[model samples]
Target: MTAITLIQGDITQQSVDAIVNAANSSLLGGGGVDGAIHRRGGPAILAECRDLRASRYGRGLPTGQAVATTAGNLDARWVIHTVGPRFTREENRSELLASCYRESLRIADELGARTVAFPAVSAGIYGWPMEDAARIAVETVRESVRETESAIEEVRFVLFDEQAYEAFARHVR
Candidate 1:
Protein backbone atom coordinates (compact mmCIF):
# COMPACT_ATOMS: atom_id res chain seq x y z
CA MET A 1 0.00 0.00 0.00
CA THR A 2 1.11 3.56 -0.68
CA ALA A 3 1.24 6.09 2.11
CA ILE A 4 -0.25 9.51 1.38
CA THR A 5 1.17 12.58 3.06
CA LEU A 6 0.48 16.30 2.87
CA ILE A 7 3.09 19.03 3.05
CA GLN A 8 2.49 22.77 3.01
CA GLY A 9 5.61 23.81 1.16
CA ASP A 10 7.23 24.30 -2.20
CA ILE A 11 7.05 21.26 -4.46
CA THR A 12 10.49 21.90 -5.94
CA GLN A 13 12.18 21.46 -2.57
CA GLN A 14 10.82 18.00 -1.89
CA SER A 15 13.45 15.31 -1.79
CA VAL A 16 11.59 12.57 -3.58
CA ASP A 17 12.33 10.17 -6.42
CA ALA A 18 10.06 12.16 -8.72
CA ILE A 19 8.40 15.56 -8.55
CA VAL A 20 5.25 15.98 -10.62
CA ASN A 21 4.98 19.29 -12.46
CA ALA A 22 1.60 20.67 -13.44
CA ALA A 23 2.96 21.82 -16.71
CA ASN A 24 1.39 23.42 -19.78
CA SER A 25 1.20 21.40 -22.96
CA SER A 26 3.93 23.47 -24.56
CA LEU A 27 6.39 21.98 -22.05
CA LEU A 28 8.48 25.10 -22.64
CA GLY A 29 7.86 26.39 -19.10
CA GLY A 30 5.17 28.85 -18.00
CA GLY A 31 3.95 30.43 -14.76
CA GLY A 32 3.01 28.83 -11.47
CA VAL A 33 4.52 25.42 -10.64
CA ASP A 34 5.75 24.95 -14.19
CA GLY A 35 7.90 28.09 -14.18
CA ALA A 36 9.07 27.37 -10.66
CA ILE A 37 10.28 23.91 -11.55
CA HIS A 38 11.95 25.03 -14.75
CA ARG A 39 13.63 27.88 -12.94
CA ARG A 40 14.84 26.03 -9.87
CA GLY A 41 15.59 22.82 -11.70
CA GLY A 42 17.95 24.83 -13.90
CA PRO A 43 18.66 24.87 -17.64
CA ALA A 44 19.06 21.13 -17.94
CA ILE A 45 15.33 20.67 -17.46
CA LEU A 46 14.57 23.22 -20.15
CA ALA A 47 17.07 21.58 -22.44
CA GLU A 48 15.34 18.26 -22.12
CA CYS A 49 11.94 19.87 -22.56
CA ARG A 50 13.20 21.50 -25.71
CA ASP A 51 14.34 18.15 -26.97
CA LEU A 52 10.95 16.64 -26.19
CA ARG A 53 9.32 19.50 -28.08
CA ALA A 54 11.63 19.05 -31.03
CA SER A 55 11.44 15.32 -31.27
CA ARG A 56 8.14 13.93 -30.12
CA TYR A 57 6.01 16.70 -28.66
CA GLY A 58 6.27 19.18 -31.51
CA ARG A 59 2.61 20.01 -31.12
CA GLY A 60 2.99 20.29 -27.34
CA LEU A 61 1.95 17.67 -24.83
CA PRO A 62 -1.75 16.97 -24.73
CA THR A 63 -3.80 17.62 -21.64
CA GLY A 64 -4.07 14.57 -19.35
CA GLN A 65 -0.81 13.18 -20.74
CA ALA A 66 2.55 13.07 -18.97
CA VAL A 67 6.26 12.75 -19.71
CA ALA A 68 9.53 12.69 -17.76
CA THR A 69 12.68 14.74 -17.78
CA THR A 70 15.83 15.15 -15.71
CA ALA A 71 15.37 16.81 -12.36
CA GLY A 72 18.41 18.95 -12.99
CA ASN A 73 19.26 20.82 -9.78
CA LEU A 74 16.30 19.52 -7.79
CA ASP A 75 16.68 16.74 -5.23
CA ALA A 76 14.75 14.22 -7.31
CA ARG A 77 16.05 12.11 -10.16
CA TRP A 78 13.15 12.90 -12.50
CA VAL A 79 10.45 15.51 -12.96
CA ILE A 80 7.22 14.10 -14.27
CA HIS A 81 5.50 16.73 -16.37
CA THR A 82 1.75 16.32 -16.69
CA VAL A 83 -0.54 18.67 -18.57
CA GLY A 84 -3.66 19.39 -16.60
CA PRO A 85 -6.90 20.37 -18.27
CA ARG A 86 -8.37 23.80 -17.79
CA PHE A 87 -11.50 23.59 -15.69
CA THR A 88 -14.70 24.38 -17.51
CA ARG A 89 -18.19 24.47 -16.11
CA GLU A 90 -19.78 24.04 -19.54
CA GLU A 91 -17.91 20.85 -20.24
CA ASN A 92 -17.06 18.02 -17.88
CA ARG A 93 -13.29 17.69 -17.88
CA SER A 94 -13.04 15.82 -14.63
CA GLU A 95 -11.69 12.70 -16.26
CA LEU A 96 -8.94 14.71 -17.88
CA LEU A 97 -8.12 16.21 -14.52
CA ALA A 98 -8.04 12.74 -13.01
CA SER A 99 -5.87 11.58 -15.88
CA CYS A 100 -3.16 14.01 -14.76
CA TYR A 101 -2.59 12.02 -11.59
CA ARG A 102 -2.99 8.67 -13.29
CA GLU A 103 -0.62 9.47 -16.15
CA SER A 104 1.93 10.99 -13.81
CA LEU A 105 1.93 7.89 -11.65
CA ARG A 106 2.27 5.73 -14.74
CA ILE A 107 5.34 7.71 -15.74
CA ALA A 108 6.69 7.45 -12.20
CA ASP A 109 6.24 3.70 -12.24
CA GLU A 110 8.15 3.59 -15.48
CA LEU A 111 10.98 5.53 -13.93
CA GLY A 112 10.98 3.30 -10.84
CA ALA A 113 10.17 6.24 -8.59
CA ARG A 114 9.30 5.25 -5.04
CA THR A 115 8.36 8.71 -3.84
CA VAL A 116 6.50 11.48 -5.69
CA ALA A 117 5.37 15.00 -4.86
CA PHE A 118 2.41 16.53 -6.70
CA PRO A 119 0.82 19.93 -6.75
CA ALA A 120 -2.91 20.65 -6.94
CA VAL A 121 -2.97 20.26 -10.68
CA SER A 122 -5.24 22.80 -12.44
CA ALA A 123 -6.29 24.31 -9.13
CA GLY A 124 -4.17 27.35 -9.72
CA ILE A 125 -4.24 29.29 -12.95
CA TYR A 126 -6.31 26.64 -14.64
CA GLY A 127 -9.24 27.49 -12.36
CA TRP A 128 -10.08 24.04 -11.01
CA PRO A 129 -12.08 24.31 -7.81
CA MET A 130 -9.79 23.63 -4.88
CA GLU A 131 -12.09 21.23 -3.10
CA ASP A 132 -12.85 19.23 -6.23
CA ALA A 133 -9.23 19.18 -7.27
CA ALA A 134 -8.21 17.88 -3.86
CA ARG A 135 -10.88 15.24 -3.87
CA ILE A 136 -9.96 14.01 -7.33
CA ALA A 137 -6.28 14.02 -6.58
CA VAL A 138 -6.55 12.15 -3.31
CA GLU A 139 -9.04 9.66 -4.69
CA THR A 140 -7.17 9.11 -7.93
CA VAL A 141 -3.84 8.56 -6.23
CA ARG A 142 -5.43 6.16 -3.79
CA GLU A 143 -7.09 4.22 -6.59
CA SER A 144 -3.99 4.23 -8.77
CA VAL A 145 -1.87 2.94 -5.93
CA ARG A 146 -4.29 0.16 -5.21
CA GLU A 147 -4.72 -0.87 -8.83
CA THR A 148 -1.19 -0.80 -10.11
CA GLU A 149 1.73 -3.06 -9.23
CA SER A 150 3.96 -0.04 -8.86
CA ALA A 151 7.14 0.80 -6.97
CA ILE A 152 5.61 3.91 -5.43
CA GLU A 153 5.71 3.82 -1.66
CA GLU A 154 4.90 7.42 -0.82
CA VAL A 155 2.80 10.07 -2.56
CA ARG A 156 3.05 13.58 -1.19
CA PHE A 157 0.66 16.40 -2.00
CA VAL A 158 2.71 19.58 -1.72
CA LEU A 159 0.56 22.65 -1.26
CA PHE A 160 1.73 26.23 -1.31
CA ASP A 161 -0.73 27.63 1.21
CA GLU A 162 -2.95 26.87 4.17
CA GLN A 163 -6.12 26.74 2.08
CA ALA A 164 -4.70 24.26 -0.36
CA TYR A 165 -3.37 22.20 2.52
CA GLU A 166 -6.73 22.21 4.24
CA ALA A 167 -8.49 21.33 1.04
CA PHE A 168 -6.27 18.31 0.52
CA ALA A 169 -6.39 17.48 4.21
CA ARG A 170 -10.13 16.96 4.01
CA HIS A 171 -9.68 14.24 1.42
CA VAL A 172 -6.54 12.69 2.87
CA ARG A 173 -7.98 12.46 6.37
Candidate 2:
Protein backbone atom coordinates (compact mmCIF):
# COMPACT_ATOMS: atom_id res chain seq x y z
CA MET A 1 0.00 0.00 0.00
CA THR A 2 1.12 3.55 -0.68
CA ALA A 3 1.68 5.87 2.27
CA ILE A 4 0.11 9.32 2.24
CA THR A 5 2.28 11.97 3.88
CA LEU A 6 1.70 15.66 4.47
CA ILE A 7 4.37 18.37 4.74
CA GLN A 8 3.79 22.05 5.36
CA GLY A 9 6.59 23.35 3.20
CA ASP A 10 7.63 24.37 -0.29
CA ILE A 11 7.05 21.67 -2.90
CA THR A 12 10.14 22.75 -4.82
CA GLN A 13 12.44 21.62 -2.02
CA GLN A 14 11.26 18.04 -1.71
CA SER A 15 13.79 15.44 -2.64
CA VAL A 16 11.65 12.77 -4.17
CA ASP A 17 11.77 10.73 -7.34
CA ALA A 18 9.19 13.06 -8.87
CA ILE A 19 7.62 16.39 -7.98
CA VAL A 20 4.13 17.23 -9.19
CA ASN A 21 3.69 20.79 -10.47
CA ALA A 22 0.23 22.33 -10.31
CA ALA A 23 0.78 23.87 -13.68
CA ASN A 24 -1.45 25.96 -15.86
CA SER A 25 -2.37 24.76 -19.36
CA SER A 26 0.28 26.99 -20.90
CA LEU A 27 2.98 24.84 -19.26
CA LEU A 28 5.44 27.63 -19.97
CA GLY A 29 5.03 28.81 -16.37
CA GLY A 30 2.76 31.00 -14.27
CA GLY A 31 2.31 32.19 -10.69
CA GLY A 32 2.00 30.02 -7.60
CA VAL A 33 3.45 26.53 -7.66
CA ASP A 34 4.03 26.52 -11.40
CA GLY A 35 6.25 29.58 -11.38
CA ALA A 36 8.04 28.40 -8.27
CA ILE A 37 8.91 25.08 -9.88
CA HIS A 38 10.00 26.69 -13.11
CA ARG A 39 12.16 29.17 -11.25
CA ARG A 40 13.80 26.67 -8.94
CA GLY A 41 14.02 23.77 -11.39
CA GLY A 42 15.95 26.08 -13.76
CA PRO A 43 16.14 26.50 -17.54
CA ALA A 44 16.42 22.81 -18.39
CA ILE A 45 12.84 22.32 -17.16
CA LEU A 46 11.61 25.16 -19.36
CA ALA A 47 13.53 23.79 -22.33
CA GLU A 48 11.62 20.50 -22.15
CA CYS A 49 8.33 22.33 -21.69
CA ARG A 50 9.11 24.35 -24.78
CA ASP A 51 9.76 21.12 -26.67
CA LEU A 52 6.46 19.70 -25.44
CA ARG A 53 4.72 22.84 -26.60
CA ALA A 54 6.43 22.73 -29.98
CA SER A 55 5.63 19.09 -30.71
CA ARG A 56 2.76 17.54 -28.77
CA TYR A 57 1.08 20.30 -26.78
CA GLY A 58 0.94 23.08 -29.36
CA ARG A 59 -2.07 24.85 -27.95
CA GLY A 60 -1.55 23.95 -24.32
CA LEU A 61 -2.11 20.99 -22.07
CA PRO A 62 -5.74 20.24 -21.44
CA THR A 63 -7.18 20.43 -17.97
CA GLY A 64 -7.06 17.13 -16.06
CA GLN A 65 -4.21 15.91 -18.27
CA ALA A 66 -0.57 15.56 -17.21
CA VAL A 67 2.92 15.53 -18.76
CA ALA A 68 6.48 15.19 -17.47
CA THR A 69 9.79 17.00 -17.87
CA THR A 70 13.24 17.08 -16.34
CA ALA A 71 13.50 18.28 -12.74
CA GLY A 72 16.59 20.35 -13.61
CA ASN A 73 18.01 21.85 -10.42
CA LEU A 74 15.43 20.36 -8.10
CA ASP A 75 16.13 17.26 -6.03
CA ALA A 76 14.00 14.96 -8.17
CA ARG A 77 14.55 13.17 -11.42
CA TRP A 78 11.32 14.33 -13.06
CA VAL A 79 8.74 17.08 -12.80
CA ILE A 80 5.23 15.89 -13.60
CA HIS A 81 3.12 18.80 -14.75
CA THR A 82 -0.65 18.51 -14.31
CA VAL A 83 -3.19 21.16 -15.18
CA GLY A 84 -6.01 21.47 -12.66
CA PRO A 85 -9.58 22.59 -13.27
CA ARG A 86 -10.77 26.01 -12.18
CA PHE A 87 -13.51 25.61 -9.58
CA THR A 88 -16.94 27.08 -10.19
CA ARG A 89 -20.35 26.66 -8.55
CA GLU A 90 -22.23 26.72 -11.86
CA GLU A 91 -20.81 23.37 -12.95
CA ASN A 92 -19.35 20.23 -11.40
CA ARG A 93 -15.68 19.75 -12.29
CA SER A 94 -14.57 17.70 -9.33
CA GLU A 95 -13.65 14.77 -11.51
CA LEU A 96 -11.23 16.92 -13.44
CA LEU A 97 -9.76 18.11 -10.19
CA ALA A 98 -9.42 14.52 -9.03
CA SER A 99 -7.91 13.61 -12.36
CA CYS A 100 -5.00 15.91 -11.53
CA TYR A 101 -3.96 13.55 -8.75
CA ARG A 102 -4.83 10.36 -10.61
CA GLU A 103 -3.10 11.38 -13.82
CA SER A 104 -0.06 12.65 -11.94
CA LEU A 105 0.24 9.33 -10.15
CA ARG A 106 -0.17 7.50 -13.41
CA ILE A 107 2.68 9.52 -14.87
CA ALA A 108 4.74 8.93 -11.76
CA ASP A 109 4.17 5.21 -12.13
CA GLU A 110 5.21 5.39 -15.74
CA LEU A 111 8.46 7.10 -14.69
CA GLY A 112 9.14 4.39 -12.10
CA ALA A 113 8.95 7.04 -9.35
CA ARG A 114 8.78 5.55 -5.90
CA THR A 115 8.30 8.86 -4.11
CA VAL A 116 6.43 11.89 -5.44
CA ALA A 117 5.85 15.30 -3.90
CA PHE A 118 2.69 17.19 -4.86
CA PRO A 119 1.28 20.64 -4.26
CA ALA A 120 -2.42 21.28 -3.69
CA VAL A 121 -3.68 21.24 -7.25
CA SER A 122 -6.12 24.09 -8.09
CA ALA A 123 -6.44 25.06 -4.48
CA GLY A 124 -4.07 27.97 -4.88
CA ILE A 125 -4.88 30.32 -7.73
CA TYR A 126 -7.48 28.11 -9.47
CA GLY A 127 -9.99 28.80 -6.66
CA TRP A 128 -10.60 25.22 -5.59
CA PRO A 129 -11.81 25.15 -1.99
CA MET A 130 -9.08 23.85 0.27
CA GLU A 131 -11.34 21.33 2.02
CA ASP A 132 -12.85 19.84 -1.12
CA ALA A 133 -9.50 19.89 -2.88
CA ALA A 134 -7.93 18.02 0.00
CA ARG A 135 -10.70 15.45 0.09
CA ILE A 136 -10.57 14.73 -3.62
CA ALA A 137 -6.80 14.64 -3.73
CA VAL A 138 -6.55 12.24 -0.81
CA GLU A 139 -9.42 10.01 -1.92
CA THR A 140 -8.30 9.79 -5.53
CA VAL A 141 -4.73 8.99 -4.58
CA ARG A 142 -5.91 6.37 -2.11
CA GLU A 143 -8.14 4.74 -4.70
CA SER A 144 -5.49 4.83 -7.40
CA VAL A 145 -2.90 3.28 -5.15
CA ARG A 146 -5.33 0.61 -4.01
CA GLU A 147 -6.50 -0.26 -7.50
CA THR A 148 -3.22 -0.25 -9.34
CA GLU A 149 -0.07 -2.21 -8.78
CA SER A 150 2.02 0.95 -8.89
CA ALA A 151 5.67 1.71 -8.33
CA ILE A 152 4.88 4.72 -6.12
CA GLU A 153 5.49 3.97 -2.47
CA GLU A 154 5.11 7.39 -0.92
CA VAL A 155 2.83 10.21 -2.05
CA ARG A 156 3.61 13.46 -0.20
CA PHE A 157 1.37 16.49 -0.25
CA VAL A 158 3.63 19.52 0.19
CA LEU A 159 1.43 22.39 1.29
CA PHE A 160 2.66 25.98 1.39
CA ASP A 161 0.72 26.98 4.48
CA GLU A 162 -0.81 25.83 7.73
CA GLN A 163 -4.39 25.82 6.50
CA ALA A 164 -3.55 23.75 3.45
CA TYR A 165 -1.51 21.35 5.52
CA GLU A 166 -4.31 21.01 8.05
CA ALA A 167 -6.83 20.47 5.31
CA PHE A 168 -4.85 17.56 3.85
CA ALA A 169 -3.98 16.28 7.30
CA ARG A 170 -7.64 15.78 8.11
CA HIS A 171 -8.17 13.41 5.23
CA VAL A 172 -4.83 11.63 5.52
CA ARG A 173 -5.75 10.59 9.05
RMSD to true structure for each model, in Å: 0.5, 0.5
TM per candidate: 0.99, 0.99
lDDT of 2 by residue, 1-173 (tens): 78899999999999999999999998999999999999999999999999999999999999999999999999999999999999999999999998989999999999899999999999988999999999999999999988887878999999999999999999999
Model 2, 125: alpha-carbon shift in Å?
Answer: 0.8
Q: Which portions of model 1 show Cα errors greater than 4 Å?
A: none
Residue range 24-125, candidate 1, lDDT tens digits:
999999999999999999999999999999999999999999999999999999999999999989999999999999999999998899999999999999
Candidate 1, position 76, lDDT = 98
RMSD of 1: 0.5
